[model samples]
Target: MADRRARIVLVTLSDSFSSTIEAMAQDAALAIDRWTPEGDQSWPDATAAVWLLAGGEETAALDLLAELPTNGASVFVIGSSTDHRVAAALLKGGASDYFALPGDADVVRRTLDRLVQQEGERQAADSFADAERGSVGFASVIGESAAIRRVVEQAKRVARHDNVTILIEGETGTGKEVLARAIHYHGPRAAGPFVEVNCTAIPDNLIESELFGHERGSFTGAIAAKQGLFELAHGGTLLLDEIGHLPIELQAKLLRALETREIRRVGGTKTRAVDVRVMAATHVRLAQAVARGEFREDLFYRLNVVSLRVPPLRDREGDVELLAGRFVSDLATRHGLPTPALSPEVLSALRGHPWPGNVRELRNAIERALVLSPPGTLELEQLWLERDDIPAGDRAHSLLPFPAPLENIIRAAVAAMVELTRGNKSEAARMLGISRPRLQRWLSEDTNEPTDQ
Candidate 1:
């Protein structure tokens, strides 16, 4: 009789043992799907699956067991009470749980339930990998370098706090959100929701409402009452990526929300209480921004309670190779293709280059390589690099056109430097080899002023 709830295949050497196992499974509310010979067999599709064994068949069973698909499945083994050796052997053979039979009906049922739960988790992981841009809690930040290890350790320590806000600062593609999830899932609020909002993605005008929500008719196009990220992340962690980009108007309200532990929706009189931990990340140099009046001083102080900086991939030596292999294996598995081998030159070029875009960029490179390369292995020629092929600093110098007026060129250089350094006037002036005031005067000078050729 085939049952759909759970599947069990008895592979015992004796007919009596198989009969006993089948009867016990039926009583325990598990499905005894079939009895199969040791050769050329596959387990039935079910939530929880188990294999029964009695030792001494290691040679035959090992080959058969290795052939079973372990992905998205929970496996267990049942052994005879006297076959203690068999229990150990089955466990070593990759069975999730090993038990001696005739196992109690309740114990059997409980084991089945546990395996089913595990199977569900496996399926969830698969879904997450396919659906989301990245994995949370399950995948680590993906570098074994000392820099990454230090960040991971600090995150673990910070996660112990119940209400402390964390500020993660780093260059773009430095994996700030990955560390943020590590803190949330490993921290005191592990059971709560982990919500992320990209401050840069939302328009300046809509930001306030996005964070605090609004009642119907509060603004044009807001036809219905809405819950904001604060409400959505109640009793959990909310990650504000590119937080330095948050407009000044919304910054004040965010600070108020954090300080008062309450929020008032736009066009609504009622204030609702919320308990959420804030984790802010930025590619911008926020200290410089605060000094320049672009970012709020009080908000900066509030979020800087515990600051973590993720080192760029270039700074973390050997991380590129490690990450490339991981990405290659993962992408292949996801696409349902055989894992392609990576050549030495591929690894060397990946490591030698400074990944300005960091891990996210490397992942894109590998995914492209996997798609474009021949079926067997990935060679250096297959990798596509727009910026990686040329040094970034070199490219910056190359962008400047020659034969243009020196004054116009100087002004252009200054502007580029200012933007590159995130508007650090002092750094820009130093790079131009001029006094800060002189640089300012030049920028302040009329471009239309008659100049000596």
Candidate 2:
């Protein structure tokens, strides 16, 4: 890749204009390569940060601009045409700036200065990406439940295939981005950037520019050429979070970019090649969105190349306690609080509460507890979770709540029956209308403690 800041290329028919352009390049301490085109369309081995297109027919100028060598170079089209459509067409063809010379010369100068200002952000973004490499992976998405393990297994398998588009579907706060990051940071492109953008966060009008940049003066306020997220995330992973919120109008463009690995800047005439792996994640079910005509079917299909659904917290049996403990440990350390023993009451309360907000809510509750607790203690009251965060069957009521898991109801019944029979397994089985061996098996599934046997 040529350094885009190296020099300027002039494609012009006016000798005087070319000489003046050469003088400006000299003023900027940049080398200039002038060409008359001469019916030849090739400019191979040319490296320039900016190209000047002057004095050509509309079709020819657009074609020439489209074929111009691009190593992240900006193109400026200058001519006397006052037709608004001509400038629009040139910009749509990827001209970074269309100056209706000779009155727009000052605007062009300002655009160049703006490009210089943007270079600083570009460098910082790239450096940030480099720093993120190797800082996260599958380990960061900590979970041992079979449900989570299954998702992790699939993510790991597909992580190496960075070119394959992936769709991650899950509820909010289910750590969808964490999984996406783990896949990217541990994948073959770990050395590349890991960029994430929330589709809903940007306004509808500006999202197009945010994702696909814009040519200078392409729109009313587009004073300078700007690189979009796709350009910034080149050669890495770009996670479009909450993708279902992406506007239907722009979905076609997204699909095209995904299908072609190329994106044209907003109001630009040329397509820029981007080598990036895309991961689209949404809390809203996209199929439902498609059915509602809110999301494009083709775009959904394109993004759903490899779909993975992260299970919600309630469905992930036996993971609540594990996650709660982990959150306590992590949050405590971060808040500079001493780690307190996770009491059986706290564990029981955590396991029984259905986490509607999922892992994120659990973590927040733990953080709240840590803050509300004394320097070395984590009391149940400080947790202040669900209205009835504590389970009912804690010797006071000992009544399993309604709509409890069938298995828990079954266990409660069996335990009650065995106690009613005074530990007589055979009698209890007969009363429950089940075989003694089955009763014993259920008990064993419940626990391996000596008392269960």
Candidate 3:
């Protein structure tokens, strides 16, 4: 007997036919609903439909079955034993299975149970595939290194909660967004959208309006009302990348929004509530920025409710070779090129090199080697691991002796500092013992000056 929770809809032309099926349905402990071919009625919400056909009624039953919305459920047919040909035709016309009149209860129950189990398995597979698709890079986080595993485990733990604010700190290209997506897609709000915005990319004047939205005629460019990221992310998660770059004035407004779970659009008097889980990622340390009076203390505490740090590639030992091989294989397959084997020298060079740009840089390097290397094992020379990979002019300045001109030396030092920090101006300034504005000025001056022939 099938479970009582399983529903069966009996479609027949005569009362006797309905009564017989209804009795069988009751014996199987299944919920039963009735419908007739001549009547115009809505489709029943059932797991399977049992259609009873009388002599010469097969044509009408087939027409009705064509109009019925099965909704992924199975449809079984019951017909006279003499009309085996008609029953076979019904099977061709989308019926799952056909039984002669006086159907066996055990046979029907077994068929329904099998269909239910198959549907459940199919739905579970789809849900898992959707979760994987929703994550960053549209795939699961890859890496077996202890450092990455710890970060991933912590993210999974944080994912159990719906609205806890999370702070992910790591150097640039450390897969902060990947971890954020994993948490959001695996969390309680897995069905919801995952919205992300780079705080550092938006202009200062527009950042506030971008986060909080704007009403019609709110500003010079506001011709129509628009919803903000927070509103769009309602019932989901919002990731703020490079959050440390958010202006101090707007930080207070963000803090208020977080505190009250509400935001007022730019130039709008009304405030609206939002149900978004906030996650922030930054390469800069907010604690240091707070001590330096660059970031707000209160907002820092608000976002740091649960801190998870993504380990840089350098610290995740042996992960380089794994990631490099993966990138090579992926790129080769994508481009229809034959996958090249990594020689011992190439592997040693990959392991020994300090990956300043981390995983992102490693991927780029692998991609370059795949395109440039021929149909054989990739060698160390093809890896391009020299400091002189910088601009030809900059290389000349860096290789110059100590007696070189002070101006050349300064420019060379700035270039070296920028490279060391993976082109991060803020970190370069900190390492050079100068303010960011001063460092920018120096770069501007250097760029404006003509290169010596």
Alpha-carbon lDDT, every model: 0.70, 0.77, 0.74
**TM-score, one value per model:** 0.58, 0.68, 0.61
Quote the lDDT for 98 in model 2. Answer: 72
By TM-score, the candidates rank as 2, 3, 1
When superposed on Cα atoms, how far off is each prediction in RMSD? Answer: 21.5, 15.4, 18.0
Number of backbone clashes in candidate 1:
0
What's the lDDT for candidate 2?
0.77
- List pairs with backbone clashes in candidate 3: none
Q: Predictions ranked by lDDT, top down? A: 2, 3, 1
| Cand. 2 TM to true fold | 0.68
- Of 1 and 2, the candidate ahead on TM-score is 2
Clashing pairs in 1: none
Residues 414-440, model 1: lDDT tens digits: 665555544667756654445677667
Per-residue lDDT of 139 in model 1: 56
Per-residue accuracy of model 2 over 9-67 as CA lDDT, tens digit each: 67774443455555555655555665566756555343445555564455677877756
Residue 285, model 1, lDDT: 87
Candidate 3, 225-270: lDDT as tens digits: 4568887677778999999999999999999999999988786655
